[model samples]
Target: MSTTKTYRIILSGGGTGGHIYPAIAIANELKQRFPDAKFLFVGAKDRMEMDKVPQAGYEIEGLWISGIQRELTLKNLSFPFKLISSLFNARKIINRFKPDVVIGTGGFASGPLLQVATSKGIPSLIQEQNSYPGITNKLLSKKANKICVAYDGLERFFPENKIIKTGNPVRQGLLDIDTKRTQAQTFFELDKDKKTLFVLGGSLGARRINELIEKELDFIIGHNMQIIWQCGKLYFDQYKIYNNTKHVQVHAFVNNMDYAYAASDIVISRAGASSVSELCIVGKPVIFIPSPNVAEDHQTKNAMAIVNEKAALLIHESDLEVDFENNFGQLMASAEKQNELSQNIKKLALVNATKQIADEVEKLLKK
Candidate 1:
């Protein structure tokens, strides 16, 4: 908590926004608490974090590391070599940087970095964003001094004593969306009179979600609603044609997520941990389509946590065709349903997650 003590901290996480943004949020909070702190980020080479971390105004070092492929492939063959190389590089970085505390937010890069850090007897903490922990976080949990988690019941994957239910750190920008509603509508050039539907397919995009939206645009528009669709960069080229249509705007990536959340009435989103956290804070009626391609089918578990609370709806990719229209129609037809969901989900928001995680880090720094 002392602004004068210069604490060197290394935050590592990447490969997805779910991993990357939480690290950034934590770092941002810590920086505010310790204005003179020295910060460095470690992420996997060629991963999005290499660019994103620097963009968030921190220096980052990249390790020659990547996650192993689930299926047998040439990539899997090189896993051993990559792991060895990354471990060597992570050691060199740790020795040179001499961080007071290293933090991992769950990513392939965090595996090597945290492994080396813990072996050197340095204090380390990891943040697990999902209800179920990732392989990297699970492995790091053995040696990590603390495990900060967003969901309950994570003690099944982590040491019960080390686990803290601090919730996921959401971006500061998203915390005050209600104040930005009119400004967001103007920023997005949305008609104030029309209700908006926001579609998110995660950072890399979802093929099935895109297909469903493309196929059902008529049905959605027939309800007299406008749309702000983030189709992800991969699918933007294919879905950009919809931008020409009335009452619809398509984007590859939404830089202004606060505006995106504020300008929308209902949301259709993927069930990535970060997205779910943000959606909970945004407090919108949501329909979640969890990706089945993840390591442990964790996205479904994340969505089900909310759906079980009656805070949101879930439509698996397999059931989208049969259930999406009916579910969406009912939601759209009932304003009371929307308000109920919005109010219920809002109750679940852990708005102080970033500060609490920083408080934990401050504890580690003092030790």
Candidate 2:
């Protein structure tokens, strides 16, 4: 007689593409491996995941949750109510779903849901994409079955036995770049003759990155460089006017990032967990401009981890205005620099990370 096992998983994470994308990638891997698995996502009500998760072909439930305001504000008054409401809602979801496993990828919504799941004796796993774990992941570690980390030396935060160094999972398209360069150049309708530069500032875009790129558009082309700039959604309309007579392609988000990465000779972008992970897979020379506005200055730390290894370059937010164009042009002209960064970064690629994590999940499920 043939028998089948049904698995229920409660996946949680969001607040930004950095957290959302990695969670989705893991979910996709889990789905592929376990066709009988039932998956449910827990995200904050007003966040992007409510929309993005559904778009990724998954069902999601929202909690009336948000981060505690760092500064004294009226939202602080709502903090107690939000936490209570989220915990209450989380308990209801856990009771109803009866998830065999809960997975958190570091976001505000993950805090209560994973906590409640652990309290209920459900196996939980956390995929931490950064060098530093956040308060949510840190708090959840004590109860997590296995904590998969991308960056090393995370034992300071989580139990060593509970931790495994499975690197972050990146999007599938980004995993291979061989045939995509010509395809990407044609997709963006960019010229194959000129060296192309792509600028990405994460999903919402970086204000300082956008401002400097907009103001220095002329300087970019004057160096005889073609560009594909992801101006981000908020600045797309405002930056669209510059597309009139330049080799500049502007996008709010590049759906075909594989092609984009293949077509680009140099990248100007932000330093987020997923972005950094994908960049390592792309194995391209990057100039990272981390947003100073993030929590714990983790973006800078993420970028520096690579820069320290001679695998990528970093331009502080303050230094971009004075140094970006000159440095980018110099790097482009220096084939040696590009090769060094490319080869060194490729050494950091976790090509099988998604499947590795899925294997871990299966191991836990079997146990």
Candidate 3:
């Protein structure tokens, strides 16, 4: 309970922003509650977290680790060596830092670090953002003291006693998007009179989603809607030509997502864990185009949870061609449908997830 006790904490996660940002959000919440706490982030080397964690004003260390490929490729051949090296480095880091507790948000780097931390009898917790657990988190669950999760029915994978339905940690900026709607519209230079569609394809981008948006721009605009499309950095060159078109604005990446969400009437997004969590808070009518390329097809599973609740709609990649126009047209034609989706999705939002996860970590620190 003492703020001046100087607790040391280590957060490890990130092959993608889905894993990275949750760890950062938890760290930020913990920092405010314990101002003198020392924080260190552990992430995979050559990953985005190396750059991102530092930008968030924390020190970080990277391990020589990478996830095993699903196929029997050359990358899988290096798995053992990488694992051993990462284990050694993780032990060295834990020994030197002497953290009060360690937390993981599910990534390859977190595997070795949390393994080492638990072996040393350091109290530890892992946060699973998806409804289905990842392989790393599933393995770590045995030794992990607590498991923080976002969805229901995760007990099939994680130990029920260890599970806490803390929901996924969303960035604080997204919590109150309504207040920023007017300012966001001005920031994006969107016409207040036109209905807006916001397209998100994660940070790197989704090729299939980009193709759909490009192919359907004429159809969407015909429905009296404007577009704020985040085609992703990888596909920006291919889609930037649409930037000059009326009723459309394209960006490589959207840095101001709070503003982007605030200004939009409808959303078309890939169903990554963080994106789903943020959308639940933003509470817009969403048509999820979940990526098929992820491990275990988790994105589809993430979208289905909300779809079943009537909180959002789902259109798989293969169905987009045949189903996109009809589904979209129906939603656009009905204001009542949009309001229903918005209200249902908002009911699922856990605005205090960061604080709740941090509360679990604080309990570990106390013990």
User: Tell me, what's the RMSD of every candidate?
Assistant: 1.6, 1.5, 1.7
What lDDT tens digits, residue by residue, belong to model 3 across residues 125-161? 9999987777888888999999999988999998999
Report the C-alpha lDDT of model 2 over 1-367, residue by residue, as the tens digit.
Answer: 9988889998899988887888888889999888889999999998889999999999999999889877789988988899999999999999998999999987889999998999989998999988877787888898889999988899999999988888898887787687778778888888777888889999777888889888888888876779988888888898878788679878887777788899988888899988998999998899999988777898999999999999999999888767877787788679999999999998988889888888898998899
lDDT of 1 by residue, 218-290 (tens): 9999998999998988899999999999998999988898999999999999999999999999999999999
Q: Where does candidate 1 stray beyond 4 Å? A: 1-3
lDDT of each: 0.92, 0.88, 0.92
TM-score of each: 0.97, 0.96, 0.96
Candidate 2 clash total?
0
Clash total of candidate 3: 0
Error of 1 at 333 (Å): 0.6
- For candidate 3, the TM-score is 0.96
Model 3: weakest 10-residue lDDT segment is 1-10
